[model samples]
Target: MSMFSGTIQTLEQSLNYASAKNRAISSNLANLDTPNYKAKDVTFKNYLAKELSQPLQAKRTNSKHLSFQGEAQPAGYKTIRQHATSYQHNGNNVDVDKEMANLAKNQIYYQALVDRINGKFGSLQTVLKGGR
Candidate 1:
């Protein structure tokens, strides 16, 4: 009885991940000249894969219901620092060419997600308008 479907939720999560990744790429590029600055990256875990691997459990509808114990939801995305590699003599790991490529890729991904969300809203609007 959720208002939003799983597809929408997944799309939202993807959009957030893309935004976070963009920020990380921007930070890396901005600190390209700084010494000892480790390059940062955003990583996303596939929720669908996790869901398929886990068993179904009861959902609590009321506050009085017992909550699930010993289980925690995994983060959809996380920012990690790259400390093992360095491309510059100053101990900076950020590579300009690589960061620029990543920025372009992230921009495309963000645009695709925005287009998808707009399409979803358009379909919802059509349904609300009685298919008119």
Candidate 2:
């Protein structure tokens, strides 16, 4: 099994991704009036695909192989600008409505992830207490 096979780890990574996306969306909303400020977004689909495609394969027979610990984590997210649509008269492509909607969606997702993580910890605590 891979190190990230743990549900807690997955939730942690999701929290990070959501946080990054929140920052990007907040920035776009903040610069809605700035001239030529294109909206930016952080996509994690590629990272998810890469992580799913490559499973952990570790061989700990020799000393050299022992040092290896699964495959490296997926690369960081890339904040790409939204150049496909321009809702405002200026060069800015940030649509206040769309950004607000995205903000709400991201918040919901972030809360879900946090709840899941808390649930996992709660379970662990119960187990540690010998079902008390």
Candidate 3:
């Protein structure tokens, strides 16, 4: 019944995760000189793995609808601070080189997701135009 396929949803979720990861990387770079500022990172792979491993649950359409018992939805992506290592005397763990690399990697990932979504829409558009 849905117009959009599961691939679109997955791409959207991936885009969201990339955006969150970019934010975390940006924050880490912004506070590179702040005292005791621990580096933050979004665990996308782990989150995705855990999410995929879980069974899908039915949505409750109304307040009177019975909820799935003992099934708690996993929380969205989390930004965790790196406290195990300090790269500076101020106790900041953000390494500029590493953050820069991560930023570049994330940018490429974000772009790829965007391109895939655009392709999906393009295909839909073509279909709507009777494959002309």
Candidate 4:
């Protein structure tokens, strides 16, 4: 099987994405008191779409087979600045309430992904044990 084959790969990617998003949200919350600090976020959908759009090449079994070129997988998340309207007079855009909500939501998502991955591994273990 290919390296990126199954729900496990997707779940791993999602966990990484959510972790990165959590960091970004935490950073925004951290700098809420700093002057002129802009909020930032890492959205998984856009990044995941871009990654999924890339064509994964198959391994050549024969020497005479044509070689395929593909882009390397993303190593880390890309955080982008949030450019929405600011409510603070100091030009800071970090909304504490919204950040807290996002943090909670992200935690739930991350936990769900981890649980799903664990389930996948458990299923694999069952198969290996001959359903014992």
Q: Score each candidate by Cα lDDT.
A: 0.85, 0.83, 0.86, 0.83
List, residue by residue over 24-74, the lDDT tens digit for candidate 4: 999999999887899999965676678768866656889998776675475
lDDT of 2 by residue, 37-115 (tens): 9899998788778876765656576777644335756545667888887777888899899889999999999999999
| Best-performing candidate as measured by TM-score | 3
Off by over 4 Å in 1: 45-75
The most accurate candidate by lDDT is: 3
The global Cα lDDT (0 to 1) of model 4 is 0.83
RMSD of 4: 4.8
Residue pairs with backbone overlap in model 2: none
Arrange candidates, best lDDT first: 3, 1, 4, 2
Residue by residue across 48-123, what tens digits does model 3's lDDT show?
6776676665677799987653443443687898889999998899999999999999999999999999999999
Pairwise TM-score winner, candidates 1 and 2: 1
| Candidate 4 TM-score over all chains jointly | 0.72
Candidate 1 Cα RMSD after full superposition onto the native fold (Å): 5.9
What would you estimate as the lDDT of candidate 1?
A: 0.85
Q: Give every collision pair in model 1.
A: none
